[model samples]
Target: MPLQFQDRVVLITGAGSGIGRATAVKMASLGASLALCDINYDNLESTSKLCGATTPKHLDDVDVSSNQEVRKFVDATATKLGRIDHVFNCAGVNPTSIPLEDTTDEYWDKLVNTNLKGVFNVTRAAIPHLKSGASIVNVSSISGLRGSAQQAVYCTTKYGLIGFSKCMALELGPRGIRTNVVCPGYIDTPTNAGIVKGGEAVERMVNGNALGRLGTPEDVADVVAFLFGEESRYMNGSVVEIDGGIKGTVLGGQERAKL
Candidate 1:
């Protein structure tokens, strides 16, 4: 059966690339109205166009770290759209390998602000506008569950998302607002375009998982769509892992060196 999200207003951050872009298209195909946000204007507009959305306004330069900005963005989206049903927090950064000892204050702050606090700011602003039974999906990573060398900052932010989602689920479930985390494995997108630029990351992902290949944005988007629809009405406060089951692969080995 086709999943219908007709007229449902979905606000998605990081709508310019990767899983976020895929999710926007998927929902839009199902007739969902969308408010797409991203720091990259061109790609964000491209995604909106691909969805064939009318009134697809783009918001570039949103600093998710600032509560004021987050509130303003949500208010603006809601004012423009009139209603909000689903919110996807997907903007994030995975900087190059840098030792924790060598990590600077600026580097760490940006990561934390965008990754962890970013989700918090957006979700917090949208909560009041969310109708009962509305859903919030936070984009987390397997890095939160497990760790990687030289990725202390990334790990911390993702792990924090998991914790934040669970608490929101608990606090808002009674109001019929569902909160959940979508923890995707390695997915090919512009964020990690550097890795596949040389074909090295693809090779590691192919050998690292039970699926024997890297995950496409559509793969993750399918899961996200389910969470946003009636199919998952009873699912909340859950951490759904979408990796190829590479939980035990050797850290930084050839299995997932690309990540």
Candidate 2:
């Protein structure tokens, strides 16, 4: 049977852009009732329109780092939508590359709060509303799997998410709720516009992937949708990579370029 989410309610963070926005549109097309939020109200509104939501009461400006805001939004979604069947934790901040020695306390706190604590706040608040078969997908990055220079704090938060999701899976699996993670590598999103604006940086990334192309938001969204459906009901605490085969290339960078 084809995948369908009719009458299901899905709450999506970072619904303003990139993978989150793409997922919102995809789920809406599949007949899901959506509740979306983002720090940017304008972009959030645009995403709501794309989803064709008639009323946007459950959608608003929400800073995921704030527990109070997260709790309020979660309650509103449960109250307005009658239930929350799935949660897509896609809200996160792009990391600024800087040497470890130059990393400021302020910058570290910013990344930790949004990338790590934000997921905590949402999951904590939504746990009460979620019932059997509910799925929670947290977005991490390829940086979580391995180390990268000048990305200490970013890697920390992403790596923490993997651990956190696994724990949630163990705790909630008995209750029939599944938790999972998606790690995307070099996706061509607006958040990475500067890096992909046309230069050696973009070319290097394209070559790094075995598929020889950067992943798109839709690419990740399709996988997210599958995880939410029954096709992946047995999947829990799984860390899925949506990077166009970046994890499979065995050749050195110089040698791989020849292919």
Candidate 3:
């Protein structure tokens, strides 16, 4: 009747906030044992407290960018939880919008390391501990599907992540470990809150979608949960967009209406 993850272990990166925090809560509510990590220990602690006393949880301050940190966390999770059933690579960064020419080497590396290579690091470390029926959901962005002004580096990382996930899916498919990607647009979380400029920009983003509203972290989290669970067992190497129907066209009349 309900989504069931009882006795299953879920390893989540960037679990301190945004979609990662929301997914941790969702998995915990479904009775999953969680291994949660974020670069910020204080925020990670807050997320752990939000998961409540009932959820079996392990907390770590981990920068997903570091292969060493990721490997240590992955090993610790396997040791503490015994096995890993699902992985949500929700750790990422959105840099300030800037001209491509003005983008600094440091800025480029920061986004690439955290957004793309970070997923690679975690996935590589977690793979050995995963077995049949294990699921992996990498959080991407709609920017990866298309492109955006002033988001070159961020978009590049996300696009690369999609490709990487697809390869993993094909490679892990025979082994029965499914890999998928989630592309979320205009999610109104602390992550986006830091970037959205003014009320006008917010209004434009809200109206740009068929839903005419910003999506919550919970919205994306729901889809991630489905991908992790048996409900989406047949899905692999799938790239799902969690946008609120942004710029989607409806097929009907000569002048296509927006969906």
Candidate 4:
């Protein structure tokens, strides 16, 4: 049986890499039409080439942090695609994980604007055109639910995304729109490749989680695909955790196992 989503118009921001790239390709594989936008034109085109070749319909270079740009992109998407049915608010950033004292004004502003305000801008712009029964998936992070030792700004932004998703669901569910958040744990993507490849961090991360393996972009994409369905029809304002069972594991610093 077809996994549905055939011919559905799905909009995904940050369609360049990590979960966003994976989701765009996944939806297209299942036959969904796409409206992709990103700040990086090359990466966006890479995702476009990987999609179902339904003529793309829309490809926008948008600074998602700005409401005006986001609104324009959304308007263009609906105008070009005729309507939008699903939106994956997946644009985000990872600031240097350093001590709070080391964080600067520019760093905080940049992180929040891209990671938090970006989500808000896209969702707000798309709300009017989101058809009834449509779904909106916000890409949050494990840091949103828990603390990260050196990622305060990043954590704060993701945590804010979770809150935004909840409030969005409350306001939009009445109109048959569903909003939800997905918090991914240590996904091994190009975005996090630097940290994941470090010898010490890699060994420790492996032993710390139940799965004993880092998450792939596709692992998160699978959950996103499920949430975009009737299986998750009743799941609104919900926070779906995709943390490799790390949330339930005991918290501590343990010696890394020899690989």
Candidate 5:
């Protein structure tokens, strides 16, 4: 049977683009109503349009890093949408990579605040409103599992998110609330567009993945949908990897051979 989300109220951050937008559209199609928030109002509007007639309550210019903003959004979502059955914590930023020596305090804070603290803010605010059987899916990265050359700050934030999600799962499990994180590798999202724009870079990314292709936003969205629904009712505190076997290759040093 197809996974169904009839009447579910889903709260999604970063719904302006990439995995967040894709998930919103997917859930909308599955009959779930949406409450979408994004720092980019224009992009968020575009995403809402793509939701195909289901008017999602939009909170624009919501910086997830701000607890106040996050709380306001969550409160509005619950008050407007009724209840938040699922939360997709997908609002994150990937700045250009810099070496530790070159990294500035501002850069570190930006990544940590947006990537790690943002998750905390959103989840914290939504928890009080999330009823039993609710699900929270956080968008971590393959970098969360392993370190990259010049991504010390980014890695730290992602790794911290994993730990945070696990703890949330344990604490919330008794309440019938599930918390899980998704780790995607080399997704062809706008966030990574600059890195993969060159043919050579694109080839390297493809060859690095055992699937021989980068993942699409929909690819990650499908997993998010599963985690949000009864299909993954038994899943909690799970760290799902949607990396197309990249974890095995990258961590096992198989990618070294290709280089």
Candidate 6:
């Protein structure tokens, strides 16, 4: 039988585009009711339409970095959807990469607050409303598992997510709630548009990965769905890497080139 979410109530942050949007569409197709939010109203509306959700209560313009806004959104989702069975904490930002010395306080603050603190705010607020069998899937990056060049702030935030999710997993486990983090590599999303347009850079990235191609939002969404379902019932406090084996052989590529 196919995986199904017949009556599940799912709350997805960053549901405007990319993986979040894909997940929303996928879950909706599987019969899950969605409460989606993003900072971009236009994109959020587009996603809602794509999911065929016409109700105003199903969508919101929420900045995950703000505790008050997150609280309001979560409260509204619970009020509208009744209860949240799964949460996809996918709202995040990726500023231009620069060397550590060149990084500004403003840039660092923006990334940290949105990426790290954002996840915390949403998850913290939703915890009280999450049912016993609830699942929380946080979207980290391959940079979280391993450092990247000229991405000190971004890496820091991603790494923080891993630790934060692990702690939540442990604490929520006793209550039958599961928390897991997904680390994706070079996914073909708006955030990586620059690299995708840079012909040679894109090739280099593909060559670095064992799969020999960039991942699509759907690839990650499938895994997110798995983690949210009963198949992953025992998968608490786990860090799943959906990087197409890039992390395993990234350094090996350098060694081979040196040879």
Query: Roughly what TM-score does model 2 have, to 2 decimal places?
Result: 0.92
- For candidate 5, report its TM-score: 0.92
Off by over 4 Å in 6: 1-3, 53-57, 247-259
Model 4 score (lDDT): 0.80
Report the number of backbone clashes for model 1.
1
In candidate 6, what are the lDDT values of residues 1-259, reduced to their tens digit?
4438867889999999988998898888777889999999999989988887533337899999999999999998888878888999998886455888998999999999999999999999999988789999998887788776677787789899999999999999999999999988777776564354567667776776888877788889889999998888999989998877883533311111100
Best-to-worst lDDT order: 3, 2, 5, 6, 4, 1
- On residues 1-259, what C-alpha lDDT tens digit does candidate 4 reach at each position? 4849876789998888778889998988877878888899899989888875664558888889999999998998888878899999888876465688998999999989998999888988898898788999998877778775666787788889999999999999999999999988767777564354568766666656788887788998889999898789999999988867873532221221100
Between candidates 3 and 6, name the one with more favorable TM-score.
Answer: 3
Tens digit of per-residue lDDT, candidate 3, span 5-43: 999999999998888999999998888999999999999
Question: On residues 1-259, what C-alpha lDDT tens digit does candidate 1 reach at each position?
Answer: 4538776789998888888889899888877878787777888878878887463453555767888877888898888878889999988876556788999999999999898888888988998899986999998887778887887887788888899999999999999999989887777665564344546556766667788877888998989999988889999999998888874733442223212
lDDT of each: 0.80, 0.84, 0.85, 0.80, 0.83, 0.82
Give model 6's clash tally.
0
Tell me model 1's lDDT, rounded to 2 decimals: 0.80
Stretches of candidate 1 off by over 4 Å are 1-3, 53-60, 250-259
Quote model 1's TM-score.
0.92
Per candidate, the number of residue pairs that clash is 1, 0, 0, 0, 0, 0
The 10-residue segment of model 6 with minimum total lDDT is 250-259
Which residue runs does candidate 2 get wrong by more than 4 Å? 1-3, 53-57, 193-196, 247-259
The candidate 1 region of ten consecutive residues with least summed lDDT is 250-259
Q: What does candidate 2's lDDT look like per residue over 1-259, in tens digits? A: 3438987899999999999999998888888888899999899889888888553336889999999999999999998889999999999987766788999999999999999999999999999999999999999888778776677888899999999999999999999999999998777776674354558767877887889887788889989999999999999999998777785432221211100
If both were scored by lDDT, which would come out higher, candidate 3 or candidate 4? 3
